[model samples]
Target: MQINVSTRHGHLSSESRARIVRKVEKLERYFERLTSIEVTVDLEHEESPTVDLRVSAEHKHDFVATGRASTLAASLDVAIGKLEQQLRKYKEKVQNRHRTSGRGAGEVPSLAEREAPDVDAEDEEI
Candidate 1:
């Protein structure tokens, strides 16, 4: 997956950028076909150091996650956690739908067997 890191309203350090790359790289273990990710880090100039982590990935559909924390690491953790939940839910839903769509061999109706009509009740019409 290609990860693009951007910082707004603050000077991003080399370590901070590397941290984001490392964290996003780990997502491949869960979803290998990830297309891209965008991470935005903002440091509060007024009070505490607040960071926001946002991630976007491509699969059967687009998945997005966002979270804020006092630290960049914590924020990234929450974002990844949310993404994991989404991927799991997507997988389960697809599996459930596929399972429900299948019909067993017993459910098949042969043309002759289905067209044979009721011999015993043919005399008594409904």
Candidate 2:
């Protein structure tokens, strides 16, 4: 998957950028169909940095999450957690939809078996 890490109103050191890339790459484990990941860090406020993550997957709209914390790393972690929860829930829903056809494998009752007991009562009266 393609990963782009961009900063706003500030810059990150090579080491810090590398760390962010590494962490973001791990998101693929949650959903293999991920096509791209975009990480936007807004450093406009020095005290509290904001991180926005946008993840795109096959046949789905982008999954977006935002996090703000005292440190950039902390903010990124929070955003990752939110994205993980979203990906997990979506994956479960997709799997469930494809896993079953809304019917069990057991044998279905015949038309006679489904009829009401009035049929048996009429026969008994005859």
TM-score of each: 0.66, 0.81
lDDT of each: 0.71, 0.93
TM-score of 1: 0.66
Worst 10-residue lDDT window, candidate 2: 99-108
**Candidate 2 residue-wise lDDT, 1-126, digit = tens:** 899999999999999899999999999999999999999999999899999999999986689999999999999999999999999999999998886667765566768778747677788898
lDDT for model 2, please: 0.93
* Model 1 Cα lDDT, one tens digit per residue, 1-126: 567888777877899789878877887676555677777666754243444444455544677777676677777788878877877777678777887687865687789999898887977774
lDDT over C-alpha atoms for residue 119 of model 2: 70
Judged by lDDT against the true structure, how good is candidate 1? 0.71
Count backbone overlaps in model 1.
0
